[model samples]
Target: MIKQVRVVLFLVMLFTSIVLLSSQTSAAAGAISWTKPVERETKQAIKGGTHKKQEFAFGDGDLYWIHQVTAGQNQQPYVVTIPVKGESATFRYRAVAANKQPYWAQVSLRDVRVLPAASGFLETENKSVWLGKPIVYAALGKGTIDEKLTLAPPVEVKKTAGGYVLQVRLPMRAGLISEMWALESAEPLVIWGKESLEQIWLTLDVTDQAKWLYDGYYYKSPSTYVPYTETSYWRIPENYVLRSFLYTGGSKAALDMGYVMLKASLKQQEQQGYWKSLPRSQWLQNDYGISEGFYDTRFNTGAAGMMLKGCALYQEGEFCDAAKRYTLFFQQHAVSNHYVVEGTRPGWLVADYATVGKKSNTHVSLNHQLAEINYLYSSYLQFGDPTDKDLADIMLGGIVNLGSRWIVSSGDLHYAYFPNGTFGRTDYPYLTYNDLVETQRLYKLLHGMEEPTIGKLMASKLAWMEKNKVAYLTIK
Candidate 1:
């Protein structure tokens, strides 16, 4: 009898301790929780569509709506879009009611890592596409791996007139590289966190380069995505085996970094034999018997060319040379004379204007590629080697001369495309983040030159795309 009583008492004490610990843990850390999925919908009715609040591991302090925007029969626009804060790795919470019902909650990035302090926004000329503010990645010097993993301080935002200021002081982690990296945004958002801090996981590649290259955008390790860096701006092909996004959401600076990797690849080509095109990694097509590729594919021509043109504006000798090669190289990537790009993933392919509808019925990012290459080719001609004007003209002409029908206009608000060309009512969406600055700069640069009336008119359209953000931006 006494033994039974003792066992019961012990169990009671253990239960009390567990309850106390649970209560204390809940009291600490401002975490979010939701039981049931909250009912939500988009403000617009689409061409006729609905949006649902899909809880996901978006970026820090972020939420998303996973929707199937059906424009017509047999066509479904299944998209997972994040908030104005853009993309962030986040833990999602959903409750049918407030905190009253049984909820579903996840733990990942709280999305607190996104957004910028007004002072730290993309500090660049016109806040161009794919620009990187100078960031120094410091590796873990002499600490145990455990010591490097510590919590960082908080990130805060303050509002003023138009926009508010964001303040962030994030920690760096160390792993394979000596240094890690950060991102540059079209807005003033700053990202620094405990996991990516230099004191944590940092490493240098085989050539002694810093590990930041592998520390890509969404913290997707180089082992996953083709190119490591800010993958947040774009996504890998669903066919790819990547389980995580190296970088989440749209980041212009990350695009620029990808460009740098390409230039470096060109320089390294003469020195190394493995990467004839892909710099730090390899470009492998299951169709070809090329050397098996590496996990990092950031230096592909399409991505690289975009970065190269942006760099050509300033980095003269080496930058210009690399940008030129990248421009021509992009020509090699098209399918059947169209500018649609191909690489590790088919979805990553960017096609020439009007190609998406005329070529096939599949939903691909053809316009996205057109918008990217149009600016890149134009930028190279205007800023870099003037000798490459003929080459630029050829490609730029291809992008613009897709069809003769009147398309929607490129406004400061959104991208416009040909509505009457029989592609249905598809409108050219605005290229926010990196795409905007690149297009605008390229347009203005081209506008300054003597081109055909159509080209000049096109340049005017891009200018509107550049300035349209004024209405949406708080301008802090």
Candidate 2:
């Protein structure tokens, strides 16, 4: 009986050992080996002494070893290596700024075949280049890069003798945020039985906020909202950011950030119930030849509308109160102060921008009118205020009366109506369409009937977009 028991115990122990060995082998096969440069290699590769290494995990279990080099009196370059194991590998890259100041970086990846080169134009004044894979090698061997390279915002690539060189630039005070920009390669870049490397010039723009967002760095206590000290763009909570958080059913972190931003906006409200113009906003407006003085009507309307949205979505009394203040200012002050202009027709037009104690700008932008109409109508629905509906109706009537006059020769709408009775410039192709759709929905909700003019306008814009094969156009 004792010998039989020992045999059973021995069999169980042997089976457990085999299972453990198999599991260990499997894990070793799946693991990735990341290599960093030694001190001698680092000194030879980078010109600056501010080189630092850190690790980050972005999505799921993917890990990256980030090596940073700060640019001093001269631009600095640091080499990077990405090892491809299977058929391919993909990675993301971006250049950040410390403040709103502009920055630039140059990246050169060697001995690898990059797939799906960056394409399309951004809203800025940068040109694009176009080069096929074969053309890239031929041109590079000839010692001349082509001018027609595809233009991708934040990054543009040109072919090099060994591989590719990418030029990246950040616009000054543009307040632009981007989605993850990815680079994928077709195969591993092997150099003499080793992995080929890439070189990039990284600037010292990494902040606590950036590290927290990208690298999961823990802070003792983080701010509810991103502060201006982190990035200049967050000096004031942007209306679009607030709307995104509340409308999209965002995560808890996003909601907390949005709530704090809403409170900050309320605190910044003037005695007259409007916020002052942000210099960053003025810079963008200046690009479009739109001069905003003490305050902008369009910006205020959007801001107040977003606040009201937050009130209804979150059931927050503070947001409701702030929105009501703006509503009262609009009804009592804007209406009597000539900010609301009466057109030749029975409709009314809201000024695009204004200065304190003076008449507003004469040019009436279609987007501004539509946005105000949408806001006022939404206000009416939320607060049961007849004045809001009345104002919205008149402003909407102006759009209907203008009709084809607003439509350019290309079936697109003119950006704005000048005081000289002429429409000029190009508006964002889809912004007016979205505004019209919302206005039509509200009109039907209020009157129990569809607005035919708005429907026709929407159809016209859609047809033009389909004809031109335009998915999006970045006007700003």
Candidate 3:
């Protein structure tokens, strides 16, 4: 009886010890503390500036300090000390406007390892002195203005004897900048007590890129038209938005948002399986010079292709069914109705726009043709349809045969081939290139060989773009 009583007591003590250790571990994980700048000193005051310093106690029991200098100029410098306790750390900085005016700032992080959590457009070439390391910089800007955001080049990084200094460009106006730091190997989805590390998963600035969509604008009212520009509410395609969410590691929140967008896009499909082009009179006047609703082949192909992708990604049968509907519509109605122009080449030249209750627009944009070919080829691979492959090959032949006619003097491909036998206008440099690359990839997968013509055109366009330094040129 005494032995039994002693065993029970020992078990109770062991349980008590385990409980105490668990509580201590939880407390250590949850602890986060920080201190604001103790002193603010007026700098040389070129246009009125100040230097401030602050310290933070990251739950890992290390001290990180930020010494920032803000001026009324385009460039501000932030020096952050690396924690001595760990081999690496991840930091997030956000800048917002104080007033209602448009605010913009670019942050360049230096001395830190470039992890996948660094979400920004990384510069390939060292454009500035601060961009020497594996530099990833975020361009943060927000406003109600309809103008496109023209981002300045990344500022250079300077490492002083004291620590690593990052050059930040201040907005033209006053703004507030917030910073969050975590361990380098921290799991983004894991909530460290009250501090959320969710932003690390995003590869782009969520606040500036598609902010409205991410903020549940479309989820709230899927049918409501959101203005993209002064004339169009449908500039960014739903599929592109969905793709962004899916490509960014597919977090639960992102997948949920993607599902909402996929369903919304599926609901917007017409009975004929084609999404109608912009019906807004302003968009029509600005783009096509006609107010009639039409079926844009390029847009339709993109939306349907993305639907197919969503179906595969989310394993949703409804998305696949919708995609099949579009494929059937393209084969039966589009092909049977002869909404194509007989090209000088071997294959049937697809029309760019099929107007509602009106004659189809026969202008053949190179990008549009390539996009349809890619979609058809992808569909063939997915749905195992021989007709899709045949059509893709036929259209691809037209592109090959009509080669030099599309090539401009500068070796860049002409945007479109009008019915009047003239090539005019300019497409975005990378848009057509991306379509060509995808087509080549799909073709190689199907045939186990590379198409020389596609390769040549891709090389030519790439050369031209590199020669002209045509980075970030958004024509539309």
Candidate 4:
């Protein structure tokens, strides 16, 4: 009898410890839990459609809603929410209209404020709400102002249980609704508790780079459906894969995708072996690609660096040939003081940016120059070529010569580099997150290459990004 009693006691104690440990872990992680999904019908009835529309809202600090207009149809909109601990809540939605005609939907969030301007009232002006200052009420689609999806006021907010329901109406043009109803909205709202960010990040599967790349918006369009970044930003396809690679902290799969994208980009290379800034297919499809004109130094050097990183990561000889070819092409084009120019002409693909803009003129971009040096150094690391290293050093000097032109306010890098000569007012700027990540990446490659000055600058940038809570784990 005593033996049986002892066994029961031991079992009870073990179970109690397990339960306590589990709860402790949960508390330590600061996990966020989803509320039971609440289904709410649209504010008004559909005028002529046979289908009744309903919106299902889920709360994880911020509200996420799925508008089901055609419940029976399989081609419903896809809204993916990536909640980071700080910064904005990234909501990527794709709304496909069933009609073939020009279809349009508008998304609005009413009665919201950025700061407290009035005690209990939201000030409105010309369809925009004023918190401390006036902001447009809608989260516009990633399109030009005159485009069907890109309206000035798209977001409208209404009072909810605790906060507000940000309603975004997406309007897609007729017949093109199915193709055009895709956008990522980074709505700004404050959610309490650290778990809000932790839960979302923890739920992210580390191996799923495609999903991360799609959600992260590190790369612009055509590479992914909805962008994490702005739509107008033309980036090398390899940059997205590089983002996924760094986000995963050198995951083998991301490295593989980087190889795949670079190889695919190589196919887009013109007869002269230099890639056009946008792929031929993308140019044929989108107006923005055509408007940007062709070729930029960022695209070529960035792509070459991506290929070299792949060669180093995978140890494949296939990438080595392409890397060498690209390096040689860059060497042949050294126009002024080993600096490559911005735009290119048709036949010889000569540098010429004036055709694109009235004021735009040919010049070296500091970012692109650094990007080439990054590639050259990587090639040196992979092939042990002294010449590549020498070129990298030479290019570094050119970049340093332009350092006084950096947008330094109060003795800090303002993150914009002159794309037009050093005298121009319009320097191509980067997103806060991208700037930090790029610097972090530069630091990673240059730390052991006798480039302490650049490393220190990168370190400062990284610190600033982290202090602002804008440094995501990938950059860290």
Please write out the lDDT profile of model 1 over residues 1-476, one tens digit for every residue: 01121232232222222222233223211222212222233434433333222222223322212222222222222322112232233222222236433233332223344332111222222121111121213222111111112232233433334332334332222221111123323442323344332111111111111112222221222332233333111111110101001112112232233333333344433221212222121222221223222211122333344334334332435544554554454444333324332222222233322211133222223234444445355545546655344444444454345423323444322222222223323333232323333443455566674334234434444556456542222111
Query: If the candidates were sorted by their TM-score against the true structure, best first, what order would they fall in?
Result: 3, 2, 4, 1
How would you encode candidate 3's per-residue C-alpha lDDT over 1-476 as one tens digit per residue? 01121232232222222222233223222212322212222333434444444333334332223333444444443334332222222233333356522222334345543322222222212111101111111212221112223332233344444434434442322332212221221223222223222333322233333222211111111122222343112223334445445433223334444555576678678777877644333443344544534566766786797688667666778888999989887775446433333455466666676655455545677887898888899899788989899988888887887766777889898887776667787755566776777788789999999888898898888788889886422211
lDDT for model 2 comes to 0.46
Best prediction by lDDT: 3
> Cα RMSD to native, each candidate?
24.3, 22.3, 21.3, 19.9
Arrange candidates by lDDT, descending: 3, 2, 4, 1
User: Candidate 1 — worst ten consecutive residues by lDDT sum?
Assistant: 237-246
lDDT of 3: 0.49
- Evaluation by lDDT, superior candidate among 1 and 3: 3
Q: What's the true lDDT of residue 224 in model 4?
A: 29
Cα lDDT listed for each candidate = 0.29, 0.46, 0.49, 0.35
Q: In model 2, which runs have C-alpha deviations exceeding 4 angstroms? A: 1-237, 278-293, 332-345, 472-476
lDDT of 1: 0.29
TM-score of 4: 0.41
Residue 428 lDDT, candidate 1, scale 0-100: 32
TM-score of 3: 0.53
TM-score of 2: 0.50
